[model samples]
Target: MHRTYSLRSTRAPTASQIQNPPPPPSSTKSGRFFGRGGLGHALRRNTAGAFAPDLAKKLSQLVKMEKNVMRSLEMVAKERMDVAQQLSIWGEGCDEDVSDVTDKLGVLIYEIGELEDQYVDRYDQYRITMKSIRNIEASVQPSRDRKQKITDQIAHLKYKEPNSPKIVVLEQELVRAEAESLVAEAQLSNITREKIKAAYSYQFDALREHCEKVAIIAGYGKHLLELIDDTPVTPGETRAAYDGYEASKAIIQDCEDALTNWVSQNAAVSAKLSVRSRQLSQRRRNNIKRRSEQGVGHDLSSQDAPLNDEVSWESTGQQQDEYDDAEEEEDDETEPSKHSMLLNGDGSNGEKRGRSQEAVAA
Candidate 1:
């Protein structure tokens, strides 16, 4: 039997310890005025937003709360390991079947603790990503302040000195400030959306994996329980000798192999939506598509004036070409008639020609 499997103290490093080193003890004493919960957790939650920039205060508080959550998980993992060790120690003096099963259960429980510790690390990744959003929010505040200040100054000057030369200069400064603020606001919006999606996706993925692995451990723990003989025996009759030692060991090995090979794609549990849920989900998707189409239509309608202007300019150019061609054809037709009239020596044609020549000379 492995010494690591039991609570026996040994100078040499145990297999369990080597594989998953225990986390360091928390720096703060476990029990103070707040008991095991720690005073820092309460203080952190209540005071986190007090000093944060106005724009970032709420998110800053959220980040602090997440830190508290991580701390709680760490405490839980450590306690779980302690309980596992205690369980193994208490079972050492029990019947052979009881001892074997409890020890194996301890192994599974300790593995759960290790999984929790790892989950805390992944959760911190999410918290750090959220901090990026807070940082961007804090940086954007200055641009907003600058724009507001410029507008106030321009307003104050226009009221006190309506014709002040400085008003024009301040107006120019205000325009530049507004432009800078616009860019800063746009960057803040883009980064907030991107980081929020990334952070939550990371958190949910970690949570799913942790839960699935814990479920796997629980199932195998139940298998280990079956090794013990639970049948009612006569008070004087002794139970049969324990022959499940090898079987118990096999169960533990199988559990370890299962956990080692587990992956997201191989998850046994799934959330299958019911018919109503499927319909509701599809309806939501259709509504989003409809709204998007409406938005595109609105955008196109707003652009109609420019498109109409371009079409009118094209049509005007074509009309001008036709007008020029018509004038040239009319001039060609009239010139022949005027020449024939001059050949007949009509007095009216001669008089009109003399007047046209006099008007040209004039």
Candidate 2:
């Protein structure tokens, strides 16, 4: 379609043009619309007229389908994430289970170690027990053999002492020897049986190893068990024992040295005390000499009475010969000598002796 408009159409709009004067009706070519011969009606049918509402409906359906597809894709992606997370959780669970198993295995190893120690200790005791049993058996065997020999000897003695009444005593000795032999044989049998039984007793290490094997078969770790079992323990135990022995020896040596030092110190103290006593005595003698000198000085300073009180100082007689007659005058009045014999003085002769006593006291 082509549409041609002429200026002559302004004369009069013809009814024929409205009814049947078009080339092709758009409504007839496609679908129905209101009968139209006007430009406004044709333009309305062309664009916003015919296709507008249907296009809006089709666009709305497309939008809905698109939203559904996006939602489905999103759901699929979410499901994938959930699956991945579940797998991670399962992996973690598996790891936890493995860790738990390993921990149990470790605990089992420690138990086995303890059992091993007990086993070794028990083995040592068993060896001693066996030795004791052997010793007992050996003793019993000898006693039995000796008793048998004695029995044979008494029987022969009876035969040799024919016609002697001592034969009855010899026969009695033979019966006693046979009884002792039987008793010795019984004792030996008992010791041997006990030793055999003790040899078969279960050791702690053997039991522990058995339990470990059982656990290993029950889904525990086998390699770890073997590794733990094969660990080097003997060297460690030997080292510990040696260290203990060395420490004990060192302690004993220290004690001995301490005792020796204590004794030496005591002897030294005694000797020092003796020397100090001698020095004190010497100092005492020196002190006495110094005191005597001080007393002498004091006495000289004071010039007290004479120190010799046992002797008396008499008055001088001045009467000369009578031949000089005038110069010699005799006193008729005479007082008797009042100073008689003197008593013994104290250690010192004067008041200085009292000072000496005070010094000694101080």
The prediction achieving the highest lDDT against the true structure is 1
Q: Can you give the lDDT of residue 224 in candidate 1?
A: 90
Each candidate: RMSD to true structure? Answer: 36.4, 70.2
Q: Which stretches of candidate 1 lie over 4 Å from their true place?
A: 1-36, 273-362
lDDT scores of the candidates, listed in order: 0.65, 0.33
Model 1 Cα lDDT, one tens digit per residue, 1-362: 42333211122443333444433432221222333246757766777766555787798789767867877887787677667767877787788888778877877787787678667877777887887787677666666766788789888988999899999998987777776666667677667778899999878877887898899899999999999999999889998888887787678667766776676777787889999999999999899799988884222212211212244346634644453343223113322332233225461211222111111111
Residue 261, model 1: Cα distance from true site in angstroms: 0.6
Off by over 4 Å in 2: 1-117, 155-161, 164-166, 187-195, 204-362
TM-score of 1: 0.69
Tens-place lDDT digits, model 2, residues 1-362: 10111111112322322332322211111221322124423332233212112213332233223323322333343333334233323333333333223332333333233223223333443334443443343333333444567567666766787577766775765566566556555555555566647644523333343344334323323432232222356643632211122222233233223322322112221223578898999899899799988884222212222221122111101111121121111112233311110112321111111011111111
